[model samples]
Target chain A: MGITGLFLISFLMVHCFLNSLIFINDGGETFNLGAEFMAKNWVIRAMEIVLFGGLLWHIIQAAVLTRENKKARPVAYAASNPSANSKWYSRSMGLLGTILLIFLIIHLRHFWVVSRFTDEITSGKETLFNEMKEVFSQLWVVILYCLAMVSLGYHLLHGFKSAFQTLGWNHVKYNSMIEKIGVIISIVLPVLFAAMPIAIYMGLIK
Target chain B: MSGNMNLTLKVWRQKNKNAEGKLVNYQVKDISPDMSFLEMIDVLNEQLIVKGDEPIAFDHDCREGICGMCSLYINGRPHGPKDRITTCQLHMRSFEDGQTITIEPWRAASFPIVKDLVVDRSAFDRIIASGGYVSVNTGNAQDANSLPIGKEDADLSFAAAACIGCGACVAACKNASAMLFVSAKVSQLALLPQGQPERYLRVHNMVAKMDEEGFGNCTNTGACEAECPKGISLSNIARLNRDFFVAGIASDN
Candidate 1:
């Protein structure tokens, strides 16, 4: 679970970096060039398969873990003070991951399915930024993206350091540093992903 | 500390595993502040015995903190209202006059109610039996200092060894995770030379046994540590994960 999670963390970094190219504000020239490279590149395409596999494996692991968690406590406590134990984000990883799954489904349907299964993306001739504009044109789509980003933020906040901790990468001297880095990465990545759709909807990015 | 306090008790009473359980209320008059929490329970039991009623059943062994037998969830905190103290060590002085204290057993499917406050903790025992010890030869024990372990490692291992296999960590967990308990055992042995031969297998087999027994994954809540009578730190859990992760990669060959 931690391995796949860290894999996605790295994937998100590359994903967000690519998405940020749209902010170049050069009318989608650079964004489409990058998108074309991603679409046509064999290595990136192969990695895409691995990414999907990692995603599915992670989802399955989560479902099993959550089921086992529920089974562990057949009867709920009459009273609990969970906030006193850990941060809400840390405790709510399963819920956040589920939400992120929903976001991923919507996101893939909007972009990936079209890009791969069919030539509907028209990426070679038409810039993919237009795809973004069309998708974000709907207020609800933009809203959903923003909402999913919130879940992603919380998920990453717990997940980043948890991955390292689970992998035993923790050091007494460096554990705090890793946690601080995890916090910064969690917030920054999701905010950037969310900003793209909001900016497009508001005409901040054209 | 000489004064006595009047208080109402809401204690869970269940006939057995299949019976429906509920909070049965009782009143105790003049509970001495000087008495330990279990002593007060003893007083209540004596009252019930004189009245020819079934006395409430709870788990306990040594009145001191060492034994992990006492597993009461009092006022929503395991081992009563005090921090780092078992139910046997909690004092009546922690309560106020006319206070209503609610007591319940550990809530977990793995720990079904046996009769009242006592739940079956054999699940923990099974996990321990799966692999909680070193594979030692049947002979005279080696000299303690022969292993040449560092003082830092020795102290940490001792602290982890302090775990008495109490199910409080499971009861205190939101997910009912036994990570702290299992990790404590894992760390205790894994730190020693005796555990070197089966270190990887111990974590692998023990964690599998834990899951097979239907315990939840560790979410790193730190609740187990806070409620632990022995003050078992979450660092042990981190070490367990590290060992388990390494084992997984290593065993791939």
Candidate 2:
């Protein structure tokens, strides 16, 4: 889970970067070029497979852990004050992950499945970008994308440091620095991913 | 005011391991503010005994907070509503004159009930047994300063060694992960040369045992450090993780 989580973190960075190209706003020329390279490259095609497998494994790992945790305490505490102990998101990983899971399904259906399963999203140089513009034009899709990115941000906030901790990559001095970096990455990465839909929907990059 | 108060207590009561438990309310009138939390409970137990009812059962040994046997979730905080102090260290004066103090056992999937307010924490024992020790020593061999340990290492080891095997970390956790407690033990031994022989294997065995015991994975909530009466640091957990990671690759025979 730790390895795969870190893998996903890198995947998100690459993904957000590709999506950010849409900001170039040259009628999707640059974004389409990058998207075409990703689609055509054999190395990336193989990695895409590994990425999905890793994601599945990650989700399953969380579910199993959650189940064991829930089972460990057969009976609930009479009264709980979880908020006092940790942040609400720290306690709500399953919720945040579930939200991201929903967003992933919608996200893939809009682009990935369309790109691969049909030429609908890849029939031209600007097909994928056109799809993004079409998708984000809907206020509800834009809202859902923003909400999902927020969830992703919160998930990574705990998960980034947690992955390193799980892998045992820590030093007394370095761990604090790593955690500080983790916080910035968690916040910045999601905000960057979220900006794509919001930017397009607001016509900032038309 | 004479620093005395009358308060109602809602204490958790369970008949046995399999039976259902609930909060039983009791009135302890005119309680002195000077009494320790356990002393206050002792007074209530005395009343219950005199009234010919089964007295409330709780775990306690050294009432000075070193034993770590006193486990209570008072008013939703582990070891009561105080910072860095065990329930044994908490006093009645911390509460208001007419306040209602709700007390419950440390509930977790890992620990189960022996009776009311006394869960069997032998799971912790099993984890320690799996590997919280160095196998190299039962006899005296080395001189006191022969090893030339660093001051920082000694202090860090002592800090980790301070954990009292209390399940408060588990109780306070949202996932009931024992990473903090496990890390404390793993860190203490791993810091020393005597512990070097089994360093990798020790962390590997302890962590595997922790998982096998049905404890949840850590989400790094930092609750364990917050509720630890000994003020156990969370950094030990990271060290444990580091060792565990190393062990996975390096411990191969």
Please estimate how well model 1 matches the true structure, expressed as its whole-model Cα lDDT: 0.87
Candidate 2's residue-wise lDDT over B100-196, tens digit each? 9999999887888899999889999999999998787535546646778899999999999999988999999877889999999999989887888
Candidate 1 chain B: 10-residue stretch with minimal lDDT? B138-147
Model 2: what TM-score? 0.95
On TM-score, the leading prediction is: 2
- Best model per DockQ: 2
User: iRMS of candidate 2, one decimal?
Assistant: 1.4
Q: List model 1 lDDT by residue over A170-192, tens digit each.
A: 77899889889988998899899
After superposition, the stretches of candidate 1 with alpha carbons farther than 4 Å from their true spots are A117-120, A123-125, B1-4, B135-142, B245-253
Off by over 4 Å in 2: B138-142
For model 1, residues B1-253, the per-residue Cα lDDT tens digits are 3488988999999999899999999999989998898999999999999999999999989879887998888888888777888888899889998999999999988888999999999998898899997768624547765668889889989999999887889988888999999999999998887788889999999999998888888777678998898999788988999899889888642
Alpha-carbon RMSD to native, per candidate: 2.7, 1.8
